[model samples]
Target: MSDSLAEHVHYLGLANRSDLYRSAISDCIAPDDTVADLGCGVGVLGIFCLEVGASHVWGIDSSDAIYLAQETVRKAGLDKHYTCIASSTFRAELAEPVDALICDHIGYFGIDYGIIDMVRDAAKRMLKPGGAIMPDKLVLQIAGVSSDACHEKAAAWSDDIVPKVFHWIDEQARNTKYPHEFAPGELCSAPVELGQITLNADTPEYFSFEAEIEITSSGRFDGLAGWFKSHLGNDVWMTNSPLDPNGIKRSQAFFPIARPFDVQRGDRISVTIRARPEGNFLAWDITPRGGPTQKQSNWATTILAEADRATLDGPLRLNDNAQASQYILSLVDGQRTAAQIEETVMRDRPDLMPSQQGTRNLVRDILKRCAVS
Candidate 1:
């Protein structure tokens, strides 16, 4: 690989925060536990797991970085306990059932690299039933704004590709910098559903999404801001355009931003996002065709707490809100329990126990409604 490409891959190995991952796997580890790091990418996280006393650690990656990870293992003299595999996550075989799975395959907005879905599938095949995943939760957020700095960076693409941003992003791959930008305080922390990434994979090759979004703030919005915030356990997490670490930036975690787009106060900007698999990640396009933009796929709710609601065409019935409605919805996927969800919410909003209770109740109610639907 060229020096820059190698640098980017290597950076991925070191750039991530291992402390968060270490703390996450601590609870799930046993002396003889078998662990698999999906999309291992140079095996830094796996190394940390081994250091913390995991018995057997396997790191899997589709990229060339698997070799680098192997070298790192040998250099660390960990060859006996840690193993590296150079193959696509979907096709890899394991020596035994895994006790836990660690995956940080998340990309900008959580879907670009198909990591989340990969996690779900890998977890299904590799992990023992009830085995935990490192990141228990992930969320995507969105907002409206035209950013000049963002436009300028995306415009720096080579002559081999089109100069405009947000259209056919795959053609702009030469620009190593990830395209797309987020404006200050412009994100709507929307609730998301699982399968956001998997649905795209099932979508026909020529697929797209269009929506109307009203700009809440008047700024030169050259494009939309999309990002994913992930919590590795009950305690550790990271966010693109993070609210805690101002200016730490998400480190190129966005895609398909528009170029030199302009917007005014009360202006409704219509936006569309398109995607297809390219290389190891999903390639996409974002277009502003009209009004306030709709939320991006990653930012929108996928599995609604009320998705199973039974609808009656006969009449509009006013259903009373109950605690069960929310509770059931929260537990629909079997991925999270009521107590776990409560703990997560409490960590983020410590003073809102009542609100959390109400939210959980509503979730159960929604699930009940969906079940009857």
Candidate 2:
């Protein structure tokens, strides 16, 4: 099966995940409500809205999965109530504002997946004033772990296994986040509520917080684990926390340290987590009282995929694509239609333009960034 097909199948097969989403959508959506499923994978959530009597449903996805979503809705005889938008959230334009917004962008660690940015942008541009958002609030939790494998996994830099010239690769591996494979029972410290997230006018571009974890059991402190509790309104809630019985069937993100140390009951550890503006770059510091701190940050260890230093440090200049982009964006004035703008670009900037098909993609790419609302 294709990647998208396999993803949809996995989502559908998740135990109790769909049932909970169906319940949440049904509770908030009314018969006359128009719902938009932002990042709708296979439009499963959009179909749920239709089954619950929504007047119309919009399935918005950045992938070709939207095509399959259209087919799925048609196969269910619910095509009349649904429309597929084959665009990313940045480029998607709705005929009218939606009454509710639902999405699947929330990652295992909640805010790490960028639900804040998606919800904030969607609410400002596409949602009605009083629009209801599924899983409106999220609570982030953190805990200290005691796992043999977690520490062993991070201390992977061996002369036999890897050469000294490529030590940087092992360093990057140590700073990266891994899927939490261990259970909650391995927790050395009680899970503490690090922060909460709700997208609104006042929400920050990314999350930053620090908290203290009090050790509850005597064990080796290997690393830190992160999870989330999501409130879907109407008394419905779900979590990916290993400790929560009703957590969605998903793995949490575990941050491992290079050296594992012993901690006794009542010991304290200071934990700090930070994210870049878009939440793509993550960093954390785990420090034990009176001991050395182990810092794990993708920005610190990884060079290639991290932010561009030149852009941040100096005056930048736009290239040819940017010049073409500027001309295309100027046409996005309040008055001109998309078709009208396309025709104008073809006539005026033939030198900067590509072939018939490439021109369309170029124009669409340039203007979509500014197409809020």
lDDT of 1 by residue, 244-333 (tens): 453224443444343345656565544455544331333233444543322333322223457346566566643534333443444456
10 residues in a row with least lDDT, candidate 1:
188-197
User: Candidate 2 has what TM-score?
Assistant: 0.81
The alpha-carbon lDDT assigned to residue 373 of candidate 2 equals 38
lDDT of each: 0.57, 0.81
Q: Residue 259 CA error for candidate 2 (Å)? A: 3.4
RMSD of each: 20.3, 5.5
* Candidate whose TM-score is highest: 2
- Candidate 2 clash pair list: none
Among the numbered candidates, top lDDT falls to 2
TM-score of 1: 0.58
lDDT of model 2 at position 121: 83
